[model samples]
Target: MVWAWLRIAVAVVGFSGVVAGFIVNVDRARREGQDLGLVLANYFSLFTIVSTIILIVTFVIAGLWSLRNPGRSPEPRGIALAIAGITGPILLLGIVYNALLRGLPSEIALTDPSGIHSLDVWATESLHVIIPLYLLVDLFFASRRRALSWWSLAVIVAYPLLWLTYTLIRGGLTPDPSGAHDWWYPYPFLDPHGGGGWPSVLIYVAVMLVVLVAIGAGIVAVGRLRSRRAAARTSPVGAAG
Candidate 1:
């Protein structure tokens, strides 16, 4: 019960952090004379915003459901697992990219080009760090167990594929605002004109695909292990023998 409330509290704060960061970004963009469409077009900002919203809604619903039916399982167990599976990789992607490839905000302001507020960094961390950690903890250690299938990993990967496809199509059509290239790729590595060409982009994509697969495998393995342990504890002594 205490853990349930803690999860709810964390979800609310995490959601608020993402929203705050988004507001900062939007406000800064407006001040710089950038349109709302361009601000919203950013993949990181958009993904974090949507994912946090999902966390908020799912956690709140689960918490309330638990309260109403104290001994029963949480409602929408499958959806909760699905949300965790999808957002877990995304959170990792953001953290790894920023920390390793992009450098920290203290080292270099990653949001400088985007004109987002300073506090947006913390907000970004909330999505990529806090919320992801919270979800993993809740999924593994918290009550009201749920089982996830391996096939759902395919479902999780489908989203990023669609996002990449959209990004590529849009980049080809839209001109870069920075005057650096004809196409507008969200990341420099994805830009054919500036990112060394299709070969470079393909290599990066391949590496990312491998990382995504690993993330999926890890989540599934941990989840299945937890499920099996729960099953083992609950089985009758005669059946176990």
Candidate 2:
């Protein structure tokens, strides 16, 4: 009984990741001299196109994986993180990174292009929804508890937040090749200052930070309320035990 809303939320997050990837590539190409009006017509960046196809295939596989005996006991943390890092929207950045490289002109491919958007930025921004979706999935006849715990919620919040902070500190969210060549490459979404200019970079980050903070705060509040309820329920039981 996977919750419908969780499924929808997962789908939306994936869709948004794909959109961000595509937009970043297009923006990268534009900065590289592709005409804005006729970008698709002239742009033959085939690597990413094929990469996108692979992502679609991978996503299908991931969905199938999700449907297989989902109500079992908790998944090993490593496995879920692997799936999140490689299969889900979270991994889209890495995959798209490969695509970007493949899409580049060979002579200048190693030049390390700029980003159209930030992957870390997008994931953190979207996590405001994705984590709750996961919580709801946990609620779908899975957990006996009526709601999620605050600690559980905190772990969930840290997923995207931690990643976002890591990316920014290491120059992840921008398109500049300097950041691209690092071990954590392909973070077009995180590369704000690359071609967008300082004004654009500051503006986007400011707005994104505000929205993400608000969302994180709401999640924390919800978890606190649930924790209080759970504590009240447990007090009498504890005395008996």
Pick by TM-score: which candidate is best? 1
Estimated TM-score per prediction? 0.78, 0.32
> What is the alpha-carbon lDDT of model 2 when measured against the actual structure?
0.42
lDDT of each: 0.66, 0.42
Considering summed lDDT, which 10 consecutive residues are worst modelled in model 2?
Answer: 41-50
124-183: candidate 1 lDDT, tens digit per residue? 677677776776676667776566778767866776677678777787887544444566
User: Model 1, residue 150: what's the lDDT?
Assistant: 81
Q: What is the lDDT of residue 188 in candidate 1?
A: 62
TM-score of 2: 0.32
